[model samples]
Target: MDYYNGHEDFLDRIEKLNAIGIALSSQRNAPALLEMILQGAKSILNADGGTLYLASEDKQHLIFEIIINDSLEIMMGGTTGVSIPFDPLPLYDREGKPNNNMVAAYAAINHKTINIPDAYVAEGFDFSGTRAFDRKTGYRSQSFITVPMQNHESELIGVLQLINAKDPRTGAIIPFSEQSRSLAESLASQAAIALSNNRLIQEFRQLFESFIELMAEAIDVKSPYNGKHCRRVPDLTMMIAEAVCKANYGIFKDFSMTEEELYELKIAGLLHDCGKVTTPVHVIDKATKLQTIFDRIHLIDTRFEVLKRDAEIEFLNQKLAALESGNPQNVPSLEAKFQQKIQQLNSDRTFLQKCNIGGEFMRDDLKERVLQIAKYEWVDTEGKLSPFLNENEVYNLNISRGTLTPEERQIINDHIVVTINMLTKLPYPKNLRRVPEYAGGHHERMDGKGYPKGLTREQMSVPARMMGIADIFEALSSDDRPYKDAKTLTECLQILGKMKQENHIDPDLFDLFVNEKVYLRYAEKYLHEYQIDQVDLTKIPGYTPPAV
Candidate 1:
């Protein structure tokens, strides 16, 4: 019997040795290191309850950190799901002065293990207001063993506490063995080293998020259209990426991206139009068909004055005829004719004011009349007759139609290039290296017609394509737009489908998109109920109503 007992002790010692080795190997990350220690300690001391407390930088009082009991109810004391404020509480001095129960302080200040044989009967221990903790929680005041986790350099890391190490079969708590205390203190030392490394990484990540916010805001404040675009794009981009991941689209099935990568993609979407910072606001918010700074309808007024002068000549000729006939004809008067012509011209120019308010289309002939009334001859502020617009400018002005000029179109396109330039110059995280590529590629067509780099279908990432779609969708459905009323859902989708058919978009992605019902998901989330309610079935060209 004695020989058998000796063999069992040897095996138990080996098991504990392996456990400590496993815990030490977990030095790669702080949280993982702490969890490993908890798991190891639970197995080592055979305790049902365990808690790990990280020391504050100042090593004052120990605060509640992570609890790993089977019930995990200790976290209910209100530390879960909150960022614990980093405040150092005062620690008790070894000479019986009040000291904080922080593991680092206990280990560093006392340089010894704190083992309570019976917490309920312990003298000179402060259980003061924490009695409520025991009463409400049903946690008996029994034995506890705490040790400071430290590194080889004697740096204080954190504190580890094990509660109720019990005598098996008797179901009674027992004080920790000296050997167990030594092993735990050794483990704590290893954990301290891990904690320091983790804190450094966390600080770096926070700094990165701050930079992202500043860059995103700078891009937003630069343009009116892009003002709220940044905020909305990130929200929408992340949602789409999540949906795409859930859909398990091909190679992405096994492709697991980290949270940092996802964040980078979102930032890229937010600053996709950062180049707009260089774009003039006047051009971005241009309201007129041929607008630069101001529409030249005033010049059209000059043409009307010319026409008024011609009418005066004709009126005088009529008066001369009456005089030649020797008939008494009172001249209708010089100023009267001039005033009449001015009144007619003013009426024509002012007739279309309310018409463009809600995008009320003019009759073809009437639109031409409005255009003729606007065609005026005038010198610039420089007193020079500007060079007559060429065919391209005339086409953009679309006198017969109505919309932005071609020069303005190029100016808008240049914003994407600017976006690329601005982002590319900044040193970003590795995952966000593609920010400029994705943002600049938004305007590019799948068929190689896109500007800047003109990346084709295969060159684009899923995120870039999704951002493009989201951007178009938002613009189409935006009721706050100055020119056009928000298009109904059906109208927007049909336009998107047509663009897809024209080889401007990814047909395969579009098919998966409609098949997976991406747009419906987006509509339910971002768009208003009325917008969805107004989706006219008939307006979706070639879409037949399903049989009920």
Candidate 2:
């Protein structure tokens, strides 16, 4: 009967240890996990009070973490509250002369469980001057059980201490039993393993977030106009994506993306313009219709002024000759003609600036004038004018559209190639390895008319197409550029819709975007009052369709 009873008691102890381990594992955060440890130790050992302490990195001290008690009494004169120390409590020297709480420290140092029956009356125990705490509270410190929480590698993580263990039936403070001490040790071991795993996961998440932040900042710093583009796109894209995700109802039944994946997508959206780092800043923020570095239009205006002054000089000389010959009447009409020519030149300069702002849309007639200005030859310091452009000189002069002069187009287009090259150099993990594939294809078209590789719709992934649209949308909606005002949402969508009709962008995504009112969500999140407010969507012709 005694043998059978002992086996059953051993099984009961195992069950309690497993239950406590399961409870400890359920906690996600550090505080809750520590609280579980304290409660489980109190319950397992039938202790009056228990305190869990975390070890400092140096392993020379105990840092009190959590304390559990049934009914705690406050002292009259004690200033420090019953809370654990805000800092680590240092261990004592070699002598056992009632120094600091060496029992807790010893457990952590040795990575072992220590049990002291009747701590106040134990042999070699000296409580001469340190008995003030017990005298004040009228509570005698008795049995103490300290167990080291060690990870799988036997590295000490922390210590757990149980004080004044009680007998459940008699309600009297009893010494900790051998079985209870064993159970506490086993529980501490399991808790340490679970905590180590949590720490590793949290560390990895922080590292990933840090990398994303650094990459976003680097991409923004690439160009002045692109400075705020990376920050705003993620804020806008996430709002739109989350709203659509919520509205899908049953459409997202099979879609099992977590908050983390969505966050990664937002990070990817912010980094979509990282390829622009390879693109020249001057090209990215090109202001004029025929602009590369310095605008020649101002130089052309100076030339026009010189031509008018020369004409005036010629007219004044003729007037002087006519007056000397007694024919001053001929001077009036000649002066009038000179003034008319000057007025015409001023009007033409105004027209060009307006034309430059209007250059967002392609027009054959305006484009011809733009090309004419781009082709104009400027005399170098040698007084020699050059016509044919070398590849390097193209970006040094005027361009008709976008950033690239005809010769610079290939160089600008190679940004995607650079993006592919740079990203492929890193051995990215499986999940993020496709970043290059997505970011590199942002400038590609669906009709095989894009630059570099000129990939068609059949070859592109949905993510690549999404990024392309996001890049364009952010560029259009952004007001950070000094060259052009932000395009109105109505105007932006209409342009994208036209691009879809021309087979340049994906038509399906366009429909999905408009029908779901995706741009409004984006505007609400990232756009300022100037970008979104007081705008009439109806004034935009193709933006608002007929009611039917």
Candidate 3:
């Protein structure tokens, strides 16, 4: 007997179908959407079992997405997470003929609905596997309505198959009525459209992320010393941001980021250094102060060689003049003086070599010595005497800190301004409107003493502040930087804490960063074993233990 009456039940199922259709349209997740569609169709017809198979990307086969057999207490796939162990059904035979022997495949190929009174007696279709399943489970396979799911464009997306429609009053299995089958077909059409839309969205999202990562790789690759700084910074930024959200006891305990905000921050992290794309390769790759297209230290090296040669030439000339004047004793004195000059020149050359490395602070004494070396005269290849170190070379060797001169440092800092200009001009979605603000503010100091806009802590967003910390920590901890030695875990935290105290970084983020151990997580992944020396939190400048 039929369960659905052509009147009241039909109208009620129609209402459910409408509600399910609306719900299906709003679903963004793919698995949940398929579950809803299958569950919705089952609820409408009171189905005891069902299966949903979507066409593969190549459309050569129908892949098993979900299967449910309520009578046998079996529920698999979708939200239940139980995978269907069955192999995908092929859509064509070896001879290239359509596979009409399987009901689901036949529905997909023909774009038609299949209504069967009983699987055991079904004609022109193979029920051997169905009977085998029934025997193994001690169950009866009967009364199936398989509908091909197609979008509004009339493209087949999948097949929605239902089994054992039960009479509602007596719980007896019955054939699907014409009206029930019609409603099932309608539900399948809605489901197909929803699935198609989600796939399109997922593909677009994947494409956007891939493009962002590619650009980040390009920026990082531009500088050999900073190898993966662009990649590592974003990862550390997210780790810090997530720690803030999960912090049970902290200044940011009440703060939270939505999914959209998290994604926007992630995008901002990946693109924070996008402006580096416009930065000069020479400036970015400046491993030493004397480095331009090549290290100018080599030129200074040639000049040092000339100075040594000039000393030897003077010694030989003096020796020859002394001998010619019949005073060989004067030649001995001249030779000793020449040896002292050679030793002094050797010492000065070594000192200049150390200064050119640009690793440690260039003290006032060191700068004066570099200028004094510039006063030494050496004969050029053209036989003209010139200062061993030129004005520009002296200035470079006298740099107070890491590789860059003031003008080049300004050029490096200007990348943030360029980043802001580039991102601000684009039409970002409303959710991501703050990308430029977040990326641009990474260079700004908490006390308004830093770059471009000089934004103080209160003027910046939390994510921007988080980015600043991440950027600094990555640079400090990186092993490949030519300007500095590889910093240990303790050293990194010490510098970060000192920066926090100096108002160079956000205080709350610093506290959360140190106390929550986000730095440890990052170091474990990116830093070398030698750089992972035991960190003493108590000794770190701004680190305070969480209140008990």
Candidate 4:
């Protein structure tokens, strides 16, 4: 019967060890995994306390990772929020000798397990620190089992030390049995493998994320006016996404996002404008209607100078002819005519200069005047008569809206299509499969009037809609854009509200943006001080204040 009972106890320990192995293999979080490994080992051996130490990168010292003592009610590290204040245990002495005096160090250095019946009577090992700890707490220190955790490569990764094994029946301190030591060694081996795998996975993820951020940085560096745009958009996107998740009384009240899903959305935000790299710098930074490689208005100014010189020369010749004909009376009228012509030339020069600049609105009369100017004849450097403005110049200067000509505007808008194509070519993992959709949908409108795909509100995802808002708001409030000044909070909100009314953006999000004051929060972090102004909710078009 005693033999059978011993057999049963051995089988029970085997089951527990098997259970611990499974748990260690499946655990993903590093801190929690380390804690579980230590706790599992302690439970199998009925140890009063245990400490897990991970080897430092240089392999010169063992750093405390998790420490737990049930009898002393002490827990540090490994998700405990309390830190281990003790210094790391050195693996080698000053002379490069293995520190075998320390049991944990000895196990790590020799890659072997050391089982001590009683630490106080143990030979050739230092217990001074352990003794000191016991003295302060008035607790007895006995029986120790130290195991070296070696990975598949046969390299020591860490050390696991259990103290004061207890007798199950008497609850008295006892030495660890051979079976307990064997089980602990097995557990430590499994834990070492799990830890190595976890670290490898974490390093790979870090590399991937770093690569993504590098690409975003590359795009941002290409345009000085887009300072931190790729970085800030993701911040704003996540801010709105989180706000929507927390909201309980809107269309997004039931919406939610998992950690992986949130990461996917963030990646989309960072890569949204990546295709802008393919856009021409001239088009992207065109600050005026006459801007190309250089502002052509300067060239037009030179032509105006030529015309004025011709007028002055013609007047002088006419006066000379009149005087030669013995008629001095016509000289004053000729001088007056020359002065009037000079003044008209100056007035035309001023008008063209104003036309060269871009504005929010270009009236039809100004466009017609630009057309008329295009018809004026001028002598070219080659002594040939040419129109004051070329066909291309007329087209550019006559643009009735922003600086971009229709062709250039189309080129700028093609970036979204390029973005979609580029993202679609990437073989994204399951969690990030919607990257193309979210990144590409930012340009789409709620009324299906948007570009690339023209996805309406009904077809678009909440994250895509959120990104649209983020993109518009960031562009509106940014002081770095070459084309426009940073608009104040009131101006940006009013424009966004008008967009909401026109079905250019998500209406529900617009309401939340006003009610929750997301604009204010974003402004505080990223907007220029002057851009942040008093926003009047009542005056903002299409925005109704949420019920108090």
Best by TM-score: 3
* Predicted structure with the largest lDDT when compared to the true one: 4
Candidate 3 residue lDDT tens string, 201-319: 78977898899899999988888987798899889999998999888776776889987899899999989989999889999988888999999888888887887887888899999
Candidate 4 local lDDT, 1-548, one digit each (tens): 11213777789878988998888888878999999999999988889999999999989999999999999999999998899999999999989999988999999999999999998988899999989998999988899999999999998899999998887777888888888888899999999999998998789778977988898898888778776888998899999988888888856679899888998999999899888889998888787888988899999999999999999999999999999999999999999999998998899889988777777788998888888877889899999999999999888887877789889999989999999999999988788899999999999999999988888999999999999999999999988887688999999999999999999999999899888888899999988898888887989999976555
TM-score of each predicted structure versus truth: 0.70, 0.69, 0.96, 0.93
Q: Return the TM-score for candidate 1, rounded to 2 decimals.
A: 0.70
Q: Model 1's lDDT to the true fold?
A: 0.64
The better-scoring model by lDDT among 1 and 3 is: 3
> Once superposed on the true structure, which residue ranges of model 4 sit more than 4 Å away at CA?
1-26, 322-333
Model 4 C-alpha RMSD to native: 2.5
What digit string (tens of lDDT, one per residue) describes model 2 on residues 187-302? Answer: 88887887776677679868976787787788777767767877776665565455445544333324444555565566566566656676776676666545657765565566
Mark the 10 consecutive residues where model 3 has the least summed lDDT. 1-10
Compared with the true structure, the alpha-carbon lDDT of candidate 3 equals 0.89
Local accuracy by lDDT, each model: 0.64, 0.66, 0.89, 0.90
